[model samples]
Target: MMQLFRHLRLGMKIGGGFTLILLLTAGVAVIGVRGLTSIGTTVTLTTETNRMAHEALSARAQEKDALLRGEAQTITQTQQHITAIGQQATTTKEKIADPTINEQLGAVVAAAGDYAKVFQQATEVRQQQTAAEEKMAQAAETLVKMAQAIRESQYQLLAEIQEKTQVAIQANRANVDDVSQIIQGIMQLRLTEEQFRLQRDAQTQAQVDSRHAAVVQLARNLQARLQTARNSVGTQVNDGMEDDAGLDIHTLAEQIIDLLETHHAGFTLYATELTEQLQAETEMAKQARLLEEQAERIRADQQQEFAALQQLQHTRPEVRNATLANVQATEQFIRGVLTVRLQEQRFVQGADAQA
Candidate 1:
């Protein structure tokens, strides 16, 4: 080998050796560059995916907050509307001094109060709904974490699968089980949600079946046992049973139940009447508010027309003729004001006229 190498030119040998070294170095460089590029691409893809997930989560949170805030704002607006209606009703009552309007206004105030209570109740329910949504979201997020863990386990399984070793096979089997378990948990959540969707009647039936049946039987047995005890204790005191002396316990209980039921019925009837009156008042309030809004709009339009007319007169030459449009608008504005004022006068005079 030394003799063969010695036969070659010294410069040729050096150049060939250097060229081989350079080719090997270039090959290594290409492989390193490719490895680095692959790593960088993977990192970028993972970062983009994480960013997308974060953005999606943020969007969901924002949507939830927007809904909650929107409802709260709506409730506040409704409250303000109710308060304004109440104040206007009161003022109208005092100014007109109409017994009917006063009565109607009182009914409106009461109805508004009831409506406010219902509104508060509804708001509380919304809060509960929000809480339920949050809980569901948290559950979904937890499940997502489980999915991520499952994915990691799957990767491990795949890596180990290639080794074809016992440990690898066992790990793959465990990963499969883990995946199944996660799927089962997801299914369980779905089932639980489905259960929650059951109707109230069906839920009541289930409760009766599970608990009430046992309770009923127990009560019957208890009553029978108690009767026996009383019979034994009474027998020792007397040889015979009393026909119906002071066994007024049942009768008294029945009478008490009857009294309560009567009271409840009376109260319910009164409440129903109140609700109807309030509903009528609410309608009246709505009508009054609409009329007032219309009147205000008319006034605003008239004011604008008046301002325009004034501006026109000031800007025009003293000898300039009034436009047909200006003359018509001015007449319409005066008629509108008189029409509104007449309506107010008629309402204010109504009680006295009726009397």
Candidate 2:
């Protein structure tokens, strides 16, 4: 068997199969890692951008508030000034009632009148500022709406990308398992019927039976995983986060498995063509054992990875179903405004027709 394995070209079909499996797995692992990296990077970038945008908006609001406060202060000062001037004017008018004090009182009243005019002009300027402030607030609100729309779009996009990435990772995991199983099965085919019969008879060996049972269990588990994944995906696509990570993993495992089954069928067909070439060879049982060993190793590795993935999934927080009450309220308000506007427009048309 060892000799047969030695004759097995490192570039032979068996070796090539192993290499392909490794390459596929590596490619998927790299992609998965990159996707995770991207998720983190994107989240950070969006958070920073949102923070900056909100900060800028808040600053503008604060500036507007300050301007309004300053205008208020100015209006208050002007009113006080006008009140003082009026008081001064009243005193002067009282003094002017005496003909002797009339000339001095006239000058005093004239100066008070000028002060009052200045205060009036200041008040007008303050009113204009208040109007300008209102316009700015409206503009800011419009900008906020646009930003919110953009953010919502991005949120939807983010959710979609996350789902796609999860699917990809799941598919990759399944492919790796399939490749491992296929390699094991193909290698096992080299065994002589007598040798297989011997192993079957010796199935009393707990370890051998255990391994056999494991393979069968794995297949069943894969099917169950697929079903769970389908269900989880259905829910995930709806509106909220999915709590069941296993479902997703199972779904991905199924894709690889289905592909493997297809490949295995093709391989079985090809094996028919190679039967003559294989039967001519002796010590094929040794080659079978080597292949089985390789398969076992691959299985071990896969199980480890699967376990780790499961652990990670288990650690994930359950999806929260928090309600955005504010958004709901705003939607209601918008509907009300639209209804009122429609009614007002109809009333205006009716009045115009009557006129």
Candidate 1 residue pairs that clash:
none
Off by over 4 Å in 1: 1-69, 154-158, 161-174, 184-355
lDDT of each: 0.38, 0.36
Q: Which candidate wins on lDDT? A: 1
Write one digit per residue (lDDT tens) for candidate 1, span 119-158: 3543454465455445544544554454444445455545
lDDT of 1: 0.38
RMSD of 1: 39.3
lDDT of 2 by residue, 1-355 (tens): 2334334432232222222222222222222322323444323322322232222222212322222355565455534543443354345345223342334334433433443443344344445544543543343344234323323433443445564667645543553454355335323332321232233233323343343344445545645654655566685452222222222333333443443344334333333322322332222223323434543453455445444544454354220100122122223323432343344345436645654
Where does candidate 2 have its weakest 10-residue lDDT segment? 317-326
RMSD of each predicted structure: 39.3, 42.5
